[model samples]
Target: MTDLLETLIENREMVQPNHANMLEVAHGGNVMKWMDEVGAMSAMRFSGETCVTAQVNRMDFERPIPVGDTAYITAYVYDAGTSSVKVRLITEREDLRTREREKTTESYFVYVAIDDENRPTTVPKLTVDSETGERLRQDALEGEIDGNSDKS
Candidate 1:
């Protein structure tokens, strides 16, 4: 079993001119790419094997990350099956000067562990033993529920 907290991965990238779109905000594609990278890292950490993206459930870009601000990407493996790991990803816009942050995107990514032959491989179960781990998992679950409810 792997602790859910152990699978958490956080990364930040400063939005440069090249990474921005016409409006001078980080491009959607760039944000998705960053999310994928961090999500894969979280899955690999939990599985102890190379992981490849299987699906991206949803990506809601609620706000823009302006150039010169920091884009913080956070990911963690919240659940896993025989060979699949589900990760929750959240992207936030942070002003380095003031250390203020606001969420800009949220998504769930699924990854499958692979062996040397590129075949799907089994992964250990995810465990949420600590209070913080449980809270994180619960929060992700609630977010998913809230997102889905809004569609109706």
Candidate 2:
């Protein structure tokens, strides 16, 4: 079994000019690339094998990360099949100076574990042993934690 906690991944990137559009906000493509990188890392962490993106669920760009700000990304494996891993990904726009953050985008990705030969391979079952892990899993399933719900 792979603990959900073990699959958690976090990353931050500065929105540079090259990664932004004419409006100075990050381009959706760059943000998506970051999400895919983090999601693949989490899936590989859970499966202990190379993982490839199989599918990406609805990805909505909720806001913008202007240049000079930070893109905060997080990904975790919330579920897995025999050969596929389900990862929840979220991106947040943050002003590093003030430490203010707002959600930018959220998406779910499916990754398939691959063997050395590039063939799909079976992956272990997922487990949530800690309260934090459980809460995160629930948050993924529920879209976002409710304001009234207990948070980890």
Candidate 3:
């Protein structure tokens, strides 16, 4: 059994001139790519197998990460089915020198565990045994609600 918190992953990338758009902020595509990578990592950790992205659900870009700022990405597996893991991803903009940070994006991604032959494989049961793990799950659920309500 894998605990949800055990699958949490955090990564940081600096937004350079090459990574920025004409607005001098990180490109939306680049941010999505980074989110996918981190989400896959979280799913793989929880499944203990290779994982491939199945869906990106309701990605919200709340703000932009300016050039020279760091993009802080955090992902964790909060749910799993027979062959799929659901990961919650959040991105924040940070100034390392000043240590100031603000969340800029969030999304829920799904990945399917795969076998050597690329067939879907069963994933371990996700456990939210710890307080932190439970809290993260709750937060993800709340985020989902918020994302969905915005469509109205």
Candidate 4:
């Protein structure tokens, strides 16, 4: 069984003018595209099978990544279902001049494993053996909190 806690993948891309919007920041759609791709890759690496995006929970853009900067996207599988995997994606913007980075976006995505025939396939249960894995598991659970729920 592959350890899901320590598993991670990082990808970097240079933000270009074409990727920006009228405000001169990376477009929300472009960022979403990057996240989806990275999340799918992480799910495939963990499950060892092809996977497709089933759903994406609220994706919050915390900050804007300006053009000419580098965007670093990292993904990890935090939960696994019978035929689905949940991935956490973090997007950060690295300033080229000052050498600083700021988190620009965060999101949770669920992917369904697929067979060679493109049908849903079952995936192995996730095992977390380290602190990182445990933390990720906890984060996943906490993220399930319904923000819209009314409580006294």
User: Cα-based RMSD of the predictions, in order?
Assistant: 2.5, 3.3, 2.6, 3.7
Best-first order by lDDT = 1, 3, 2, 4
Best by lDDT: 1
**lDDT (CA) per prediction:** 0.92, 0.90, 0.91, 0.85
Superposition TM-score, candidate 4 onto the true structure: 0.91
**Tens-digit per-residue lDDT, 52-137, candidate 2:** 99998878787899999999999999988989999989899999999998888888899999999999999999999999999889
Off by over 4 Å in 3: 146-152
lDDT by residue for model 1 over 1-152, one digit each (tens)?
99999999999999999999999999999999999999999999999999999999889998999999999999999889999999999999999999999989899899999999999999998999899999889878777767742220
Local accuracy of candidate 3 as per-residue lDDT tens digits, 12-117:
9999999999999999999999999999999998999999999999888989999999999999998899999999999999999999988899899999999999
| Residue range 28-101, candidate 4, lDDT tens digits | 99999999999999999999999999998988888899999988998888888889999888889998789798
lDDT, model 3? 0.91
TM-score of each: 0.95, 0.92, 0.95, 0.91
Question: Which residue pairs of candidate 1 clash?
Answer: none
Flag the better candidate by TM-score, 1 or 2.
1
What range of 10 consecutive residues in model 1 has the weakest lDDT sum?
143-152
- Going through the candidates in the order shown, the clash numbers are 0, 0, 0, 0
